[model samples]
Target: MAEPTLEPSTEPTLEPSTAPAPEPMPPRPAVAEPTPSTAPEPTPPSTQRKAARRERLQVPHEPVTVHEATAAASVALAGIRERCTSAPKVIAVELDIEDGRGQVARLNFKPAAGFKAASWEKCVRGELESVKYPARAAPSHVVLRLQR
Candidate 1:
């Protein structure tokens, strides 16, 4: 048997090319500084004064408990019942109380089975507003349902 001999294969070897290098990036344009006229305009004195006044008007007060709010509402309801000629079967009242004053947030009525809702909403609102809450009572939303 003849022994096999190893031979070198003929293949092209890769070589580095001498190519021209890419051009460098151009310099960015310089930004101009803001001039006084180009700067944001200042708020007008009247607007500033109004904002200050509003801030001063907002005074913090103590929070009103649920019990206190309900009590106030109950007292107001009595007054409302007296003012109406014929009170509805059901009265639903929602109030927003703040700074010892109550404002009617919502008022609903379910008239008696045989009658229609009378125009007593305005009277109820006025009566509710008349109820004086605690001097330091905070803003609160209270809902009350009253039935005859």
Candidate 2:
């Protein structure tokens, strides 16, 4: 068996390199500090409503009183009583009144006891038709009930 010869190592060994150092960041300029006020600024009122109510006056006149309406209607109403055969039944007259106009825009008759003649009801309506009320600020529903 032949013996193996030992060899001497002479090559220079090199060390592993580390990462390069980072450059320093430049300093930022000085900024003025904001001074707080004692009282905060007042904000204006917001009108955000999409559908606000109308500001215009509706009827443009004064309101009508019940006494005035009854006074205007009494004479016609009395004629109805005289013609009726029986004691008068309660009748409700719904009147649509316009501002500054004595004339009723519309009339609806609601009778507790039905009238024998449509003509009679209409006659009563006609007599009361000329009745006028004081001017009103808005259109009004006036109901009058009369009984004998």
Residue runs of model 2 more than 4 Å from their true location after superposition:
1-60, 82-88, 99-118
Predictions in order: lDDT: 0.69, 0.57
TM value for model 2: 0.40
For TM-score, the strongest prediction is 1
Q: Count backbone clashes in candidate 2.
A: 1
| Candidate 1: worst-modelled 10 consecutive residues by lDDT | 109-118
Query: What is the per-residue lDDT of model 2 for residues 28-130, given as tens digits with 9 covering 90 to 100?
Result: 8887565576556655435433223355445545455666666666766677677643433765566666753444333344452453455556555555665
Cα deviation of 2, candidate 1, in Å: 99
RMSD, model 2, all Cα superposed?
21.1
Cα deviation of 33 in candidate 2 (Å)?
A: 78
| Pairs that clash in candidate 1 | none
TM-score of 1: 0.46
Q: Candidate 1 on 16-77: residue-level lDDT in tens? A: 43557889999999998989989889999999999998887454566666677767667766
